[model samples]
Target chain A: MALTRRDILVGGVGLAGLTVSGCAGSPTTGGRPIPVQGATAPPGSPNLLVIFSDDHRADHLGITGEVPFLQTPALDTLASEGVRFDRAYVTTALCSPSRATLLTGQYASRHGVQNNLSAWTPGTPSFFDSLAAAGYRCAYIGKWHMPGDLPDLPGVERFVTFTIEEGQGVYRDCPLIVDGVQTPRPGTYVSTDLTDYALQWLEETDDGRPFCLVVAHKAVHHEFEPPDDLLGTYDDVAIDLPDEAFTYQTLLDRNVWEGTAGRLQTSYRRYCETLLGMDREIGRLLDAIEPVADNTVVVYTSDNGYSWGEHVLTGKRWAYDDNIKVPFIVRWPDGVTAPGTVSDAPVLNADIAPTLLDIAGVPIPAAMQGRSIAPLLRGEAIEWRDEVFYEYFADFPYQVPPSQAVRTDQWLYVEYDRGLAPELYDTVADPQQQVNLADDPAYAATRQELSQRLADLRREFT
Target chain B: MSAAAQSGAGAMPGEAARSGPVGSSSGRAWRIAAPAVISVVTFLAIDLLLAALVGRPWGPAYPLSMDALVLLRMGPVFFSGLIVWPVMRARGATRAQAVVGILATPLAFAIVSGWRAAAFFPPLEAAYYSTNPMVVGAIGSQVSSAGVGALVYALWRARRHRSGRPVSSGATPLPISTGWSWGPIVAIIAGTALTVFAVIWDGGQHLFYPWVLLYGSLFG
Candidate 1:
């Protein structure tokens, strides 16, 4: 059989054949059925598309609770069909590092990546590498925040990149670093252009092969701008005032609105408007995939939660739920036997790697810190990893005192090594965490237990 | 460089379908390169706009001049790092087709250099370490004292880059037919030596010496 450059160049046609013909069907070469995965027909292996939003809070979702007029029908459809974890968290609450955690399935500290600034060059293997090793053609389509001398990803094909480099505001026609050359997308909004590229890949690439496509959305992030078409979609929804946001203003008398750092500059109205485009974009995306959605498993979650009038902080990197909790919903109509089961149990963002591999029927590596949640999806009884740890390294420069905590079934213990006063809250008793239990003598045993556990977790993290 | 920023991120859309104003009858041939060129122009326009916005918040431009020179200075380091991937790729590197599959660095460095060099130099420091004013002051004062000296080493890199050529394809190593293989390498080494030796007359210098010269010339 002759292999021509034309076969490879067929991708130049945009709809290249993904099927690798089997030797079993060969007329001349009589061989036993040498089976293949993505060679032909429908992809025997499932496709995984993880849509990660940067600095987006879980509560902002319309389906999560009462929200200002926010439309996320596509995401809502995902929640209705897949197992939506109510409590999902990032190890480090920064952009690049959190992204690293998702790739590495390890905490930022463990991965040797602490913050967005400076070099966090990866020596560890990313989940994409593992997927590639398992014969999946992986691709990252948007929002690559991994800073400084990015590792040459072996198996992962980065078709496009929205830089996480500083001062490169996440806005329209933002310089997209593609194949290493910093170029631009032809559109008014960067998100729209990114989605366009994403859909193009979907339409063009042969879906027969198992693929890991990550579409990291830049909208619902800073200097918020929604497309003009969807600006009126949520213009009337009454915004729910979060408890942490209004009360925390007292702590910032010294640094009121003048608060300057790497904090997300967002307003209630602006954030709502910015998210409108994402909601509709999400809707449109689901519409495109809904036709042949059986084989595809779409995982929707944010890199880290953002504060919109929450804690008056205006960004991530707090022990508060507003910062850590992300909306995690996985939709696999054919894959999951039980589709609409909601799991309130704590799930770590790190779990994403193992879970994906489990669903793909690939073996989870021992090096990965995350455990698979495939059982939860299949409604199988499984032992859960209780007491998930939380971490927040200062994103705004010069702010030391890294924040760390451990959240169990009932308790939320936070230790602030940075100058902020440490606090403990009974999430079960006071859902809002309105009362501080760190100083109360009545809560001594709980405090001691939490403190020791937090210490032990720290030791484990190191 | 600042002119690029004025375009903003949302410079235009549908550049693919709409042909830009072509002056010559050779428009048909030029149209073939149009999509690639249009995409690049749109992306750079956004980058420039973002850069401009950043400049407003930070400065006029985040110059890569000295840093480019520094990277050029650390050509050995960057190239050395490049080997890890090439070797790893040769071995069991799982991901076969990376965006920066060896050829990206040169292209990226060239783009960063051609656009942001000179003006974007002296990468933001005073604003970065705003933990305490002392850290800020220390960095600012350091910038003041160091000035062009901060970039002398990076400046020396300009001569080296002038000698090299672009690797046209992502698959192959850049051909070395145009660059001064031995002569310019030695000349650069000598030139760097003389500059450092001159700085030593005052005191030992840091990396910012070249940038300090720029500041001095501007002020004087």
Candidate 2:
């Protein structure tokens, strides 16, 4: 009873069939695969490549000052090549909600995905849908953390995603659902595998139609699992930790506790290590699109910001800058007039959907609550928001109580829905959110105005 | 085996003669432990369902670490005994009664959770659960657990009967009259209303007057 080559081939096909069946109804898989048009860009249209990362802090990059010795060459290169947004913030500093905002160009309230335990309304118009309708090939690769268990996405020509245990996919030997088939044991390093898949997609896709590929990375998220090559990257590096003002112990004592207190060095080191892998993946992504670089709009950002002992907070869902602000760099070769420029315009996750639509030459839907920043990207003069509003809903895991805030250039006014007292800060003077001026008589007028403004914005948005 | 054999005539020499349908001591323990195990499994399923329906920001990889989810889920399990024990202690306690008793706890918790969510976290209900993920998840999880609990009981019963042990006599299935009681129907309606409000109705003006024009007024 010796097994022949024919038997082995049949067994292999059977295994493949089982794998495909497992991922038959996965949310990340798009429509039928389109043949590769060509290596070059589609005529008169630029391809869109958005490299999204999870739990990435704005200041953790080499250019940003969180870690001095850390080097994120790919991200730094992206920043150098395009416009970096200094004031980018997520409307709701959580993952699914923020990602929904990014996709729908709507606030958490409008999109109805206020928390991770929320689902985006199926019929809600997304930029990708509009792009696909306009004959652009849409492909979403990597982490697809939306609700409905990552069901078939609309307007996507190709969808590949992580199918590991839950939330963010596993870091090593990640389960990848490619073209609605769960590729078993798709070996090591999620970011690298994602990049390779993205590259393969770009190589295989029909280049006749312009494409939009969302290359998301599940790095720097909790557990901070890094590949073997990057495991000891920053382990030996001496890093300057945050001072007493931002100790988890201080937060615990103050009764505003969130985050790990003593694991600053270990956490930061692992974070940097994981981040380096993502950076290399970005480099690889960039390399993949090199042939069509001139005709591609490459954007890089995170779903939500992370906190490395900032305000004693370990993770996001806080109104503080560390938890809400994310690194945003867009390299649109044809659209951006001045390269390596920085825009201080207060942009948000919601702005992304509209912005993508604008780039793809699709009409911004009326359902979108965010204003397109295409003008800002092209270095044009346009009226922009002076203040950004942030909100959080209380759930079980991240016990940072539900709070709302309105942050201006100079002031930040926080209103807690439950637990703790309200906080008002002159961000210019107290950038660390250390001082509370809510009860201070001198700032009563400012607080009153900001509160009124916050209410107004909430009413307008919600 | 005949009734005599089932009553322990078939027992080995020094072994205690089997009397009732409950087979071994372990089998009896299983009968007692089945409800507790079902309760935990059902609640875990509920939590997993909620996470999946909503989207797990923390993801499923680390279910136990999600402090909020754990607390939310544990609340029902901790208080489940208040209902389960009472039902189990009722007159004519049987396998069906125990199954129903085990499931009643989650149902009560779901209603309480719905009401509390509507009252306190109105904004959350209005935003995230507008499409009713919570309601569907809660019910789906509750029913799933109930099925699992019944299965466990059924399996244990089958094993006891298969072992030729005489089952404890006089224990009857839930009466038809009791099964069709009005309490469950009313509870279902009330729970559905509360869940709907918590998941859909806004606590603002929408709470008072929910009707809104979808395509503008008829007068244009």
Using TM-score, give the best candidate's number.
Answer: 2
Q: Which stretches of candidate 1 lie over 4 Å from their true place?
A: A1-43, A164-169, A232-237, A242-266, A398-400, A418-421, B1-220
Judge the docking of candidate 1 as incorrect, acceptable, medium or high: incorrect
TM-scores of the candidates are 0.60, 0.63
Q: What is the DockQ of candidate 1?
A: 0.02
DockQ of 2: 0.02
* Superposition error at A112 for model 2 (Å): 1.1
Tell me, by lDDT, which candidate is best.
2
The sequence of per-residue lDDT tens digits that candidate 1 reaches over residues A1-462 is 111234323322222221111311122211111112332323466778888887778877777754746666767777888888887877777777788878777888777667655445644677676676666766776776665554445556544664433322456756555444445444447666666556555665643456678888886765566786655555565555543233222112112212222222224556667776776666655655554567778888888886554434556677777778888888877666777777887888888888888877777878778778777777777888788898876443222346889888778889875245668889899866667898999998999999899999889875
First chain TM-score for all predictions = 0.83, 0.88
lDDT of 2 by residue, B1-220 (tens): 5434544553321112223354677765555455556666667676665444322233443323433444556545434543343223222246555555555554544454444344334544433222233333344344334333333333443455567653332232322222223333344455445434533332211221112121012111
Error of 1 at B132 (Å): 8.5
lDDT tens string, model 1, B1-220?
Answer: 2211333332222221122343455553343333323333443454444333321212222222212322232232123222322222222222232212222332433344333322212223212222122222222222222222213322322333455521111111222233223322343354444444432222222322333333334422
